[model samples]
Target: MADPQEPRMTAKRFHARPGVEDWRVLFWGAHAFYAADSLTHAVALASAVAEIADGLDHHPDLDVRPHGVTIRTRTRRGGGLGPLDAELARRVQEFARGEGYRPDPSTLMVTGIAVAQDRDADVRPFWAAIMGYEPLDDADAVDPQRRNPHVWVHELTPPKPGRGRTHIDLSVPADHAKARVEAALAAGGRLVSASPEGWTIASPDNHGVDIAIWPDFEDFGEDG
Candidate 1:
């Protein structure tokens, strides 16, 4: 039996471990999506995953759609991937393989919005209340159902106009960051800055669009 409580595993370490190729570490957790031919097959895969999770005494969020099932696992006691998640994922993959459900890791992504504000306390409530979302913290709000993008109250040292009042966050696995930046550059988007945290890009229309790399490591280094 897998240990219910274990040492925390960083995202970089999780990827380095063998047998988790089907998974991708994103903003809040690790996710895997199985593309089934039909909804019936999708349900079967999810059901098998549920059994694996139950046996391990660890549960994951499963999203069942007509085409496929999206599964996300995060440590309940803490954040990010734990050893338990890796075991559960591998067991689920074993069952999925027999059922012929293959995962498309490239399809996994996490997105959010950043609202620049000098008065974060004043503006945060409006977005949280208006969106009917719950506060993840004092400075950020997220959809309770996890269906919508996370909203962050970004602080601007000195507020100014004709500058970015808000920005769109596009978060993906570390391996995908450079390709995404290249694609954006090809699309006429101008480069703003690049760092281990990720890339800050400006759209042709001058809107801020950030390509974020979570579990920041020099995995592939930042794009030029």
Candidate 2:
């Protein structure tokens, strides 16, 4: 028998137990992302995952693809979902969400990604200005933080002029929306559209990365 003072190797020592798996959360089970146009693009994406893993100190099983890739994570210690496993799941989900990967509730259908490209040399500042997204340095980039997800800015491959929106509408509190918009604009973002409801901000290149501000329900003049 081991001494009482000695650490005992127990089932609890494992990260996730067989019977413990959370289905409600998006990242609990195996998750995969679809879409990669080229081999180089695929490699870049894989590097991004590697970057995330090194940051978390918990590696994931990756299925790289020229058109897509899958990320599957399991807790070796617990052999199921535990505290650390949950955290890893959260990180993966956050990464997916930040990158605008929509998640489906039914079949864990979280796939598809939006691609935004900037040809200008000063693109980072432009995007940071418009999105109000905190810029992460190289150090923070490798180590995945819970708040902001990583955004990779690859070379244009071949620069070309395009005229189209590469953005989406971001609706927030009307009152706060103005401030958010202003803050984003001040950060180097450009204004594309605006109204009482909200405004759309975009990148310098007119990419569709836009935000919409909405009046709060209370401010919507509803009698409550």
Which number leads on lDDT?
1
Task: Give the alpha-carbon lDDT of every model.
Answer: 0.77, 0.43
lDDT of 1 by residue, 1-224 (tens): 22345445677776777777888877667788899888888888888898899899999889998789998887732235677878877887777777788888667778888998763235778899999988875567988877788888877768664454778988777777898889999999999999878999998999989887765332432111
lDDT for each residue of candidate 2 in 41-156, tens digit (9 for 90 to 100): 66666677677778877776666656655565544221122344445555655655566443332222221112344465435555555545444442111112222333333434
Off by over 4 Å in 1: 1-7, 76-79, 119-121, 161-164, 216-224
Model 1, TM vs. native: 0.84
Candidate 1 residue 103 Cα shift, in angstroms, is 1.9
Candidate 2, number of clashes: 14
Best by TM-score: 1
